[model samples]
Target: KINKGGQLSMKESGEKDKNECHGGDSRFMAMTLKRGRKKKALEYLLKKEESTVKAMVDLKKKYA
Candidate 1:
């Protein structure tokens, strides 16, 4: 943490800082996903939610 004067405490050192950003070794960061996927699943889910709400509003107007 920084002091009110925006200065770091002398006790704060790079040794602890190096440990925090460790995202693991390269093998752990490797991904099996294909590159440039366009998230069609999320788009589909959003469309589903929108249609459901529109449908509910129409039903409420017709039957309420």
Candidate 2:
């Protein structure tokens, strides 16, 4: 298990922060759906979708 803010640098912490953001967004979507805020949830989903797509495109370009 990773230590809590041990010797990791800011870059490492930033990566963890991004992962938490993604996870939190996913949980928020589920909660929004449960509350019948489907539209808002979908909007939030699109932002994630956009970010994922951009990441994928960058990865492809990097390897291709």
Candidate 3:
């Protein structure tokens, strides 16, 4: 789904068996960003040393 800022968002649909639901067991979410933003995110993760599964999510939000 698209959010207020026109960015893609993953809202829970409570469909546990469907990958379309952001809350699927795979725990993977997809988004699109500019190249610079992607590089910045990588730098941020490295500098902060937060590469755990949860931290990667936080990084996504921060860069988004």
Question: In candidate 1, what are the lDDT values of residues 9-60, reduced to their tens digit?
Answer: 2234535332123431111112111222225323422443454335333433
Q: How close is each model in CA RMSD to the real structure?
A: 19.3, 10.9, 11.6
Best-performing candidate as measured by TM-score: 2
lDDT of 2 by residue, 1-64 (tens): 2223221122343455443444444344445566767576556545554644354334334433
Q: Which candidate is the best by lDDT?
A: 2
* Per-model CA lDDT versus the true structure: 0.30, 0.43, 0.40
Considering TM-score, which of the candidate structures 1 and 2 is the better prediction for this target? 2
Q: Which stretches of candidate 2 lie over 4 Å from their true place?
A: 1-23, 50-64
For model 3, residues 1-64, the per-residue Cα lDDT tens digits are 4333332333446333343354321133224223445664455445332324354555367646
Error of 3 at 48 (Å): 1.0
User: Model 3, which residues run further than 4 Å from truth?
Assistant: 1-36, 51-54, 58-64
How much does candidate 1 score in TM-score?
0.24
